[model samples]
Target: MKSAAKATPAEDSAETSTQLIRDSIRVAIVERRLSPGTKLSENDVGNLFNVSRTLARAALQALSYEGLVSVAKNRGAFVAYPSPDEARQIFAARRLVEPGILREAAARITPDDISQLKQLLLEEGRLMSERGQTARRAEIKASGDFHLRLAEISGNAIMQRFMEELVARSSLVIALYGQSTVSSCGHSEHGDIIAAIEGDDLDRACRLMLHHIAHIEADLDLRERKSLGLKEAFEL
Candidate 1:
């Protein structure tokens, strides 16, 4: 699983500090490091990345526009929580939208595209196999980016950007309502979707994409129920 990365000293010198902060936050959001409704203290973030509060504020504002974070007049920036209704809506939109993208990828997919996806999946597998907890987290993050890559290859930059946000937000929703497993991602679905695309079979690609996303949606543990642990209620 792709873990969120702390800002390295080298990256701190990059141009456009605000955008770099924004990208870091985006990775955190995508990798499930920042959960829904978690408060983002501007000063804390600034301190962590060694940036000024002004740069951190700009990054938070950008995330607000992306629908990943919510900003209040007094409460400041916090991770956005999607209500159950919005969760249903976003998943609906993605299922309706992405399968078609897979179809397009099937139609226009170059061998080089398959090669690139293979490389990404191989990295994912390596991280999973080695259990390099930290590297796996980063790989987990990059895995979710596969959809955006597919969209670009499908010849739609606009939808590609939109899919990137949807995929990221999907990670948030799953984190919010899904069971607290160590893995941030399902991890294997990316290769499954790409396999359909590589077969050069559009219908299969559509079906695979739908099935993969449906699997993600079904991962939520919506029931707010739990039993008491031993010694808590019964064993005393």
Candidate 2:
């Protein structure tokens, strides 16, 4: 058997730059810094990130595959504006899977995992108190990270990937529809779920998981809103 060829330095650089752009855009979307329907012009993105248009296009295309960006013919790329029905579907999927994921995570969770979860909860609560767009964005990301971390602890690779999509989509939905200034996932609720899991109460943990997801769904207004300007939305 022949060994696989390695990527040259130039190829590695391009891939790194592309991934960096993609991740920056993804974080902006997921953290609600960028609103739905905001245009992501390749030229602007290239200039913003100091990369070529080709690299920017690649980044946008990558986000499109993740259901976080929409690329239309002749319309350019925009942050995904999920419809009300799509929002319902996103929560529906999360409600269907998160309880199971929570249970599996509980089954496999170690002491270190529990400690890490507690630490995340602490950080999340601290962020909630701080005032600033940057802190708010970090808080939102940390809230989503709680669920994503649970999926990671489940020891199911496929479920982990699915949860990633669901969480990202959920962020978009909440960004457009959420009535509260804070994320729909409550700070106390995360702590409660962790407590249940620590106490070996899988049933309560699952129920709490469902309720947590439901709280997010219940907070949605689900009406259309005008898009924020890219410069203001991204604070560029």
TM per candidate comes to: 0.80, 0.86
> Across residues 191-234, which tens digit of lDDT does each residue of candidate 2 receive?
99999999998898889889988888888997644466676678
**Model 1 C-alpha lDDT per residue in residues 12-52, reported as the tens digit of each score:** 45569788888888888777777788899899889988999
- Pairs that collide in candidate 1 are 1-136, 1-137, 2-136, 2-137, 2-138, 2-140, 3-137, 3-138
Off by over 4 Å in 1: 1-15, 180-189, 223-236
Residue 3 displacement (Å), model 2: 27
Q: Could you give the C-alpha RMSD of every candidate to the true structure, in order shown?
A: 6.6, 7.4
Error of 2 at 220 (Å): 0.8
